[model samples]
Target: MKPGTLRVWSQVHTWSSLASTAFLLILCLTGLPLIFHDEIDALGKAHKIEQWDEAQLVPLDHAVDVALAKRPGEVPIYLSFDEDRPVVNITSGRSADVPEAEMGFQPIDRRGAVAAGGGQTGGVTDFLLDLHKDLLLGQGGMYFIGLVGLLFVAATVSGIVLYAPFARKAGFAKVRRAKAPRIGWLDWHNLVGGVTLAWALVVGLTGTINTLADPITAWWRADALAHLTSGEGGAVQPYRSGLVQKAVANAMAKAPGMRPQFVAFPGSPFSSGDHYAVFLQGATPLTKKLLTPVMVDARTGEVDAIAPMPWYMKGLLLAQPLHFGDYGGLAMKLVWTLLDLAMIWLLGTGLYLWLGRIRKRAR
Candidate 1:
C-alpha cells in the first residue's frame, strides 16, 4: 500500500481501535472468568451425589412435578440434565413468556429430592455476563456491543493492512525497546496484535453473530414456528407432566441419536402455541451446540415434526460456544485466556500510543 493509503488505513485503525478499546477491554476482562464458568460454579457449590441403584432414579416427569410444586403458580419452561451427576435442573416461570430474570432454577437428584434450589437472580458471574453481553442495556445493549464488535473487526483489518508494510521492513517481533517509550510500546502493540490476529478475528466475528440471537429467535418464532403450527390453531393447552414425558420420548424416538436439552412449553416464545418444542442436541462434542427442535402436539403428546433450524439460527447457536471459547478442552480455554491477556495488553498500548501522539501534537 502507498504511504498515503497506509496513512488513511492507520487513521481508520487508530479511531476504530480507540472507540471500541474500552468496551472490548471490559468484555475481555469479564469473559476471562466466563471461560471457566463451569469450574467456578462447581467450586462455589460443591456437592456429591450419593451412589444410588438404577431403580432409585426418579422419572423425569416426577422430577418436573416436584420442581413445579416448589414454585406454585409457575409453569415448567425447561429441564436440563447434569453431565457428571444424575441431577435434573428444572427452570420454572410464571408463564410461557416470562423473562429470563424472573425464572427459577431447581435441581433434583436421582431420588427426586431437591438438590439445589434458588431464584434465577444472577450473582457476580451473571453480572459479568450481562456486562459483557449488553452493558446491562438489555437487547439494546447487545446491539451496541455488536456495533463495537464490528468496529473491532475493522480495526483488526486495518491493523493487518498496516502490519504488512512494517513487517516487510523489520522482523515481525521486533519491539525497538532501545528507542523512546512510545516507539517501544507501539512496536509491542503491533507484535502482540499480529500474534493474536486470528483469535481476535474469530472471537470478534462470532461475538457479532451472537448479538443477533434475539432477532434471529424472534424471526424463527414468527416464520418457521408459524408455518409449523398454521393448521393446528386452537386454544393453547397447558403443559401436562405426563404429556411432557411422552413428548420427550417421542422426540428421542424421532431423532434417535440426539438427547433433550430443553423443552419449550406451549405458548412459549421458542414453541408454538399448540405444540411443545423439545429441543434436542447430538452427543458428540461438535454437534452438541447444534440444536434441533422437535415439535410435539401439546394436547395429544404426539410427535409432529422436527423443525429444521435456519442457517442463521444455526450460526447464532454455533457462534455462542465459539465466542465464549468453551467448545474446546482445558488447553483451548488456557489458550483463550492467554489470548485475552494479549488483547488487553494490545488495548493498553494502543491507548498509550494514542495519548503520546496527542502529547506530541500539543507540544
Candidate 2:
C-alpha cells in the first residue's frame, strides 16, 4: 500500500479499535467463562446417573409426564437430550410463552426418573452468559454490542493493512523494548492482536450475526413460516400432553436420519398456533445446530408440514455454537479461552498506548 493509504488505514485501525475496545474487553472477559459453560455448569450439577447394564430409555412423552408430575400446573415447553448419556432434559412453564426466568428444567434418567438435583436456572453461569450476550440490556444492548463487533472486524482488517507498512522495518511479532513506553505498548498490541486475528474475527463476525437473531426470526415467521402455514386453520385448541410423543415421532419420521431436539407447542414462539413444531437435528456435528421444524397438528397429532429452515435461521444456528467455541470439545474451548485472554491483553496495551499519547499531548 502507498504511504498515504497506509496512513489512512492506520488512522482507521486506531479509531476503530479504540472505539470498540472497552466493549470488546467486556465481551472477552464475560465470554471466557461462557466458552467452558458446560464444564462450569457440570461442576454445580449432580453426578450423572450410573450407567446400567442395559438402560432402556423411556418415550419422550413419558419423560414429559414425569417432569410435569413433579411440577403441578406446568406445561411442557421443550425437550432436550444429553449428548453423552441416556438422559433427557425437559423444560416446563406455566404457559407456552412464559419467560425463561419463570421456566423449570428437569433432567430425567432413561427410566423417567427426575434426577436428584437438576431443575433450576439463574445461576452465576447464566448471569455471565446474559452479560456477555447483551450487557444485561436486553435487545437494545444486544444490537449495540453487535455494532461493536462490526467495529472490531473493521479494526482487525485495518490493523492487518497497517501491519504491512508498520512492520516493514521490523520482523513480525517483534517487540521493540528499546523504544519509549508508548511505542513498546503499540508493538505489543499489534503482536498480540495479530496473533489472535483469525479467532477474533470469527467470534466477532459470528457474534454480530447472532445479534440479528430476533429480526431474522421475525422475518422468517412473517415470510417463510407464515407462507408454509397460510392454508392451515386459525387458532388451535389446547391439546393434551399425550400428543408430545406423537409429534416427536411424526417429526423424526419426516426426517429419517434426524432426531427430535425440542418440541415447540401450540402458541409457542417457534410454532404456529395450530401446530406443534417438533424441531429435529442431525446427529453429526455440523447438522446438530441446523434444526428442521416439522409442524404437527396439535389436536390430531397429524404431521402437517416439514418446512426447510431458511438461510438466515440456519446462519444464526451455525453462528451461535461457533461463537461460543463449544463445537470442538475441550481442546477447542481451551484454545478459545487462550485467545480470549490474548484479546484482553491486546485491548489493554492499546488503551495504554492511547493514554500515553494523550498525556504527551497535554504536556
Best by lDDT: 1
Q: Can you write out model 1's per-residue Cα lDDT over 1-363, one digit (the tens) per residue?
A: 778998999999999998999999999899999888767766656566546565788778888888888899998877777655777788889887789878888888756566654334567777888999999899899999999999999999999899887777767899787878777787888889898888899899999988988888999888877777675665667867688778888999999889888888887778887788998999887678888899999878898888668888888888888898886789989999999989988888888888989999999
TM-score of 1: 0.92
Alpha-carbon lDDT, every model: 0.84, 0.81
Name the candidate that leads on TM-score.
1
Give me the overall lDDT of model 1.
0.84
* TM-score of candidate 2 to 2 decimals: 0.89
TM-score of each: 0.92, 0.89
User: Runs in model 2 with CA error above 4 Å?
Assistant: 1-8, 44-58, 69-74, 113-116, 231-233
Query: Model 2, range 1-363, lDDT digits (tens) per residue?
Result: 777887788788889988998899899899988888778888956665466533366776777788889999987777777655667788788886787778888888765465734545788888998998899999999999999999999999898777775577667889888987667777877788778878889899999999988888878877777777775656644648678878788778888999877777776667777888888888888788888888888888888788779988899898998798887889999888888898888888777877887898999
